[model samples]
Target: IGLGVIKNVTLKSGEVNGLKISEGKLAGFIRIRDSGKAELTAIGKFVNSKFFHHLRNSLILATLTVFLTLLFVVPAAYAFSRLKFFGREHILYFYLMFTQVAGGLGIAGLIALYGMLVKLGLYNKLPALAIIYAAGSVPFNTWLLKSYIDSISPDFDEAALVDGASYLQIIRYVLLPMALPGIATVAVMSFIGGWTEFILASLLLTEENQPLSVWIYTLMGGIGRGIDWNYFAAAALLFALPVFIMFMLAQNYIRSGLTVGGLKE
Candidate 1:
C-alpha cells in the first residue's frame, strides 16, 4: 500500500489485531512489532532509488578511475624509482612543480579545453572525467608510489632477475607483492580524492551526466531564493558516508603499508 493509503486504516478494539480490509488498497502492512522490518525495507527502497543510483554510479566511476590510475602509476613509479634513465630527475622535478602549481587556478584552462571537446561532441562523457581524474592523480600518486618503491630493497629485484625472470614477470611476481602497502596507499588516496572531487566533475558534466556533487549543487538557489538546506544536508551526509566507510575499511591497510618499508638497520 502507498504511504497515503496507510493513514486510512483505523484500529478497532483494545484486544483487536486485524488489518482492516480496504477496497483496492493495502498490499502489505506490518504491526508495531514489525516496525523494524518496515523501516529496513523503507531504507532499502530509498537506497535503491534514483538518488542513490546516481550516487552509486558516481562512486563506482571514481573507484574505477582510481584503479586505472594505479594500473599505470605502480609501474611508472617503480620504473622511476628503480631504473636509471636520462632526464629522470628532470621529469620527477617537473611533476613536482606541476603538482605544486596546478591547483584550482589551472581549472579554468581545463574547463575551456573540455568545453572545446564538448563542442566537438564529447561533453559530459565518463571517459573525459576518467581521463582528467587519472591524469590529475598521476603526479601525486607517482611521487608517493616512487617514495615507497625507493624504500624497497633492491635485493629483491636483483634476486628475481638472477632467477631468469623477465621484467614483466618480475613486476608481477616480485614487485607487486612487496609494493602492496604502497599500492594500497596510492589506491586509497586516489579513490578518496576522486570520490569527493567536485569542481572538475561539475565543469565536465552536464545535468544528465552530473555526479553527486554537481547534483547537490543544483539544490542551491540560482536566482534570489535561499538554499534547500534540508535536502542539501541529507545529500551531503549521504555523499560523505561512502567515502568515510571506504577510508575506515582501508585504514588498516594504510597503516600497515606505511610501516612495511621501515628501517632494517
Candidate 2:
C-alpha cells in the first residue's frame, strides 16, 4: 500500500512550492509503503514460534553466566591486583596463555567437552551451559578487572586495614564501588558472549533448551528448504535488540572502564 499517486507536474527551475519527482523508473521504490501487515505477520510468527521460551532460556544463561563470572573474577582479580604470592606473575601469565590458546577450544576440544558434559548429565542443562560460558569468560574478565583494580590506590586498603577492616570489608567497601565501571564492562561483555554464543549452545542444548541465537539459525531453513528473508531478518533484528540496548545503556561505563583498565597507574 502506498500513500500518494505519482503524477507528472510542470515546475520552473528553483520553484520552491513545486513537488519535484524523479524522472527515471523507480524499481522497488516505495514512496510511502505500509508494511504493517508484513511486520505484524512476522511478529506474530515470532510470538507463536516459542521465541519467548528461547528468550527466557537465553536470559537465564546470560544472567547466570555473568553472575558466575563476577563471583569468581572479583576476588581473583583482587588477589592478583593486591596480594603478593609465589609465582603470582607466572600464574597471571598462565591465565593469559590459556586465554590466548584455548580461547576457541577448537573442534576437538569441543568434542571432548561434549563427551564430558554428556557423562556428567550436563547436556541440555542451562545452568551447566552457563557454567561453561562463565568459565570461558573468567580468564579474560579477570585480567580486565585486575587491570582496573590495579589502577585503584592501595592507600584505601591500608586505611581500611588500619581500622581493623577485613579483606572482605575492604573489597566490599572500597574496591567494589571504585571498580564498578570495570565490573559493568565485564558484565556487559560476558552477557553478550553468553547471549550470542552459538556453537556451544547448539552442540550442548536440545531444541527445548535452545537460545534465541540457535532459534534464529533454525529460521534459515534446512535442507531443501527456502528461506523466508523477511521473517528471518525480523527475527534477527529482534534477537540483537537486547544486546544493542544493553550496550547503549552502558556505553559510558564501558568506555571509561576500558580507558582506565587499559592503563596502569
lDDT per residue for candidate 2 within 1-265, as digits (tens), equals 2224323333223311232323332212213224322111233245446788989998999999989999999999999999999999999998998788875665559989999999999889999999989998999999999998988988878878888999999889778877878898899999999999999999999999999999999888889988978778877888889898878867776565444322122
* Stretches of model 2 off by over 4 angstroms after superposition: 1-40, 104-106, 252-265
Overall lDDT per candidate, in order of appearance: 0.70, 0.79
Report how far off residue 261 is in candidate 1 (Å): 10
At residue 29, candidate 1 shows an lDDT of: 31
TM-score for each of the candidates: 0.75, 0.79
RMSD of each: 8.0, 11.9
Residue pairs with colliding backbones in model 2 are none
**Candidate 1, residue 230: lDDT:** 50
Which predicted model would earn the best lDDT?
2
